[model samples]
Target: MAAVPPALGSWGAGQEYDKQPAFQRLLTAADWRPAVKVAVAPTLVLLAAALIAAIPSDYQYEYRFQSAGFGERFGSAVSMALNALGAPFRLGYQSPLGHDRTDRLEIALRVLPMTVTVLWCLALWLGLRAGLRRRKAVVGQLTRGQAAAEALRTALVLAAVSGLLGLLGGTEWNPSGRAAKPDYFGDFGSGAQKSGQPLITAGSGWLEAVAWTAVLAGLLAFLVHGTDALRWAAWRSRAVRGWAVSALAAGQALAVTVGLSSVTAFVLVAATSESGAQTGISLAFLPNLGLNLLGFGSGATFRAHSGLSGSDGSRGDSSWGDRSSETDFSFFDLHDLTGDWRWAGLLALVSAALLGRVAFRRGLDAADRLRLAAVHAGALTLLMTVSGVLMTRTTSSSGWIGSARMEISQEESGGLAFVSVLVANAVWALAGALLVPPLLAAFRGRGAGAPQGAVPYAESPF
Candidate 1:
């Protein structure tokens, strides 16, 4: 009797996952079951928003005209909930935030939806982690393609969830041709009073849904696994510290600057408005208002118009009240009316600089880091710009006596000043990656590659 050789299965313990075909390695069923986890955060956010929406119940009449029966009331609430769910599916810049029939929702759908999108990525990452644990792989080393392939499964699931939501909400079809129909894709803005609208307008939300899917999948691979992008990269331990610092610094700064400023403004508005109830009603619009602050920070701008009372000052036209007044606050200036927003702008600049420095110092050469920074900043800026463009909806009505004759209708974007913001961010990110590290390094009297911060990992408390 002697010791016997271990079974092949036991020998395969740590590396079994790697032996599988690429497709099987990635698109397996492991990640599918927990895909539903993606919805949890978003649902929670919507529920909280609903609670806020229902707090007083005094303004409940805004959504419901009479509400005699329970079923109708329930249906309307369900509709509103679905609207909350679907609202962020637009350009990802604007949230449903609530509205006063004409007013937008008070919540920023951007943060919640982005959280859900990250959760979607997390679902896949968790699956990979579980599988790696089985394989005894600690750092989860693998090709970028493998991680991307695994991510595709989760992305598909996310898309399916989005499609399901769209189907459930946008399926407003009418067989009776007697009434005015809202635009097929009109769930966000107005109701259709007519009939014969398309049976489905589900694609409206899918664009953003798909966009999130792509972003999440890529991030899951790059941030968690380091994927193929790690080929020329240094060891994770050596590099993770730098990467984590950059991310944490930027994130914390953004949270502090953007979050604090937005909340402060909201509180001030609530405190000062003439009526508390009226103020609460306007609270639904705070999401958009906060977004205004964000635009100031990021140097992006959108437009809004209001009714004018007096005649045109320049021409002194008799029908001066015929046109709505327009203004531009797209970028932050020293003399901005709101000082808080200007601070947000400064914070954003600092964050961008930190991002460039950290990302460049992580592992890659200056050129590669430059490319990475450009790609990261450029992609995000592009998304925001495009989303802003899509979100610029214009509505016009006659002046006092039914005349929009002051000027012709123009395709307006509410001032989504993406073009300028895009240029500004790209220049900042590019220059930061290319210039900041060297400048700082020279100041410290060390070469660029010298371990600079050696800070704790982003997820680490130490």
Candidate 2:
């Protein structure tokens, strides 16, 4: 009688939670609309950013001949908008007369799509968290494969929306018409020089848009679902925390890499302006600068033809006049650049993982923290590589010009620059990620910030 009967439910809450099914606990939409909404977020964010950037007061009419007609202005605004989205893709088409700008608006706009992607991820995470917390949805039990399939379904929806929006957006600006094909590789402004053109007219974005949408959605789903499982907490395995640690570290690294690159570029530009190099910096320069900063941060270099003529760069700029066969590299290399910009890249690599180490040490053993850092760094580098692939090509003029042909592009290595960007930065970041955490853990451990059961390096197999 003194001992009394066992209390109602269970000995431990963990068993009760483990008994529940994942599918029954998962979030369910009333219909397909929420999926559709998530899918549409990227394109809508781009459009919204573009629209906001188009506040008439933000721009001043630069060319008198180019009156602020509705189509021209709209096209220019759209060009700026699309270019912002494409900046990471190495799409750096310059206007013919140097009328194209790289302003703060363009710079700000470049990151909007990425920001939207993150927001979508957070939304999915919150939705999942709510579903579990409120026990709102009821369904049959789900296997891991089923859960994965559900995530993929969300990804496909996102891809479909992106593809549709990309196609619809370009209905007006068929590059096939050719006042001059809107150069995907160089200045978008030159294309907009004529009236009635549309921004983002090149027929190249649909595949990319769809592909990116799927990738981003899938990653978002994986990241949200993997870490917050009730079962994971129940297992209490250090390995689970390692996965979570790395995932969080990787996310933080990615954000830091992007942010530092952008900020570094802006600060340097301000320095240049103050120093009177002028660099002929224009408002359009901000986007270009930020783009270049991205490249620089990822251990890539930048060079552009001031004039793509076969002569001593004595001749001037023209889209058709642009030429860069092997015979032309010597001439174009005349304006080839060399800068100390890679220092910024080193900083980016280190900074990306610095916070990751602090985070890793808090919840993970030295080996696990190191492993988590490496994993996170790898994910971060994958993202950086994708960004590099996008920003490494800016080609113009591909028709034969006499015996010589035109393959106007800044990357003399054809397309290897993107590959170079991806490889170099990834190697740098991986090294930093792998090395930094263990070193810091070793230095700071033994009494503080060590994981629950970690031992000193000398005592362990490592």
Candidate 3:
């Protein structure tokens, strides 16, 4: 039997997901279910955050049993648990430890959410980059109006994701004392509350508002620029160059700040505040695990293509023989497999695939389409990984911090929760510093190929 030529616009046919539509892409490529698998990490993170928010403002999950002297026994147990699970995501830049209970918990709880939020933001940036490229392709395939419509859809999704994450970080689930209990004294008493306004307002509210604004702007820009690239060749060309430079620069800065904030905040809070056990998942674990798998798979595929490796052995019995022995391999690099940097590699891969597919459509034997699939898949893997990690961080931290804040707001903990909340905020702020650079670097690859467009495959049902 003659080999089925790889499809260009849809998920690569003649490959594992050849039957799937391009638009149905999700967290895990292998899993087609819509529940949580497709949305994967980010969705999980969001759910986790929601759960954290759902915790009653006055509810406290306390584990206190001072059997061995003062706070020793109780503190040791909590701290131990935190240390163990916290290993994978530990950005670990702490000063000498301290005995401050509020301070320690604050640091531990804050790091995860801040790191997770920053990481998700990075994913949004990458999605924007991909959406930009995809829109450019549509402009070429359809009428200018149609291309614009498709581009708008892409931009909206990316923007929405970014907006949601920002909202997660900026908003506080547990309201404070004055706000939580407005009717201090009810029947037969004057309802003169000391503080009339909510504890969390203005600046915090403004921060979230601005975050939403930026998200919207980013989404709109990506749609306009991407479709524009296809509509007007001259405009598209300039837009591509500008988008590449701007996206890369922004990603680099954002990742760095996020990373640094996470690290520094953790360290400072761990040192000065009461230390709880390092608890919950880090922002680097699951997503990176996925990336590692992607990198290894891509590496194997590359070797196969280069003839440095052999076939799966079962191919020998196929009617087509081994003409596609090389087709089984991929061409993405390992270092370019994770972080924000993977976007650059994705663009390069798409370019090659687009050219190859066009050539193949016009009757040219080529491996470009396979390479492009490998790259795009790799980028998606990278995006999902980062998003997942960030989401995990957000969920884990939000629960801990919110619970703590509840305690403080109730005055049983003497404003300790408020302090912890601040620490968490600090950690989130610094995340952009530490994590963005390495991420941005992952996307930096040669970008000299012609732009590629993605289209739906004929065989896919969804």
lDDT by candidate, in order shown: 0.45, 0.45, 0.31
Error of 3 at 455 (Å): 28
lDDT of 2 by residue, 1-462 (tens): 597544332223544534446542332333333454454445555566445544453233332223344443443444344433342221223233222221110111232234334444556556544443332255433335544654677787766765554544422222222444344424544444453332332222456656765776776655444333423442455566566555566666556655665566667767666543343233334433444455555555443322333322223332454555432121123234664543655555556466445554555445655665566545544544333222224333322232222233333321114454556555655555556656666777643354646323342121
**Worst lDDT window (10 residues) for model 1?**
91-100
Over 4 Å off in model 1, which ranges? Answer: 1-56, 60-64, 67-149, 169-326, 330-345, 356-365, 386-415, 442-445, 448-462
Local error of candidate 1 at residue 390 (angstroms): 6.2
> Model 3 scores what on Cα lDDT?
0.31
Query: Could you arrange the candidates by TM-score from highest to lowest?
Result: 2, 1, 3
Tell me the tens digit of each residue's lDDT in model 3 across 1-462. Answer: 999856542344445554555555542242222212212344344434434333322223222111222222222222222221121211111111112222212111211233334344444445445554554575443445554544444434433443443333322121222312325335312222222211211001223323443444344444444444443443335444333433333334333423333453344345555534322233323333222233322232212221111122134422322222222323344355655434323322322333333323322111332332333333333332232221011111112322321111100001112222233223322232223222333455522233333333344221
- lDDT string for model 1 (1-462, tens) is 999654332224545555656655444435543334443444444344434544443333334133223322232232344332334422111112122112111112222222222333445566655554543354445566655654565456555554554444322222222322245435533343221222211123445544554565445534544433453243345455345444444443344433454465477578778877766654554444444454456666555544433333235444434446666665554474766545666545664666555654564455455555655455545434433322222222223433322322222234346676677667766666667777767777877764343444454221
Which 10-residue window of candidate 2 scores lowest in summed lDDT?
100-109
Write the number of the candidate with greater TM-score, choosing between 2 and 3. Answer: 2
Give the C-alpha lDDT of model 2: 0.45
lDDT at position 257, candidate 1: 39
TM-score of model number 2: 0.54
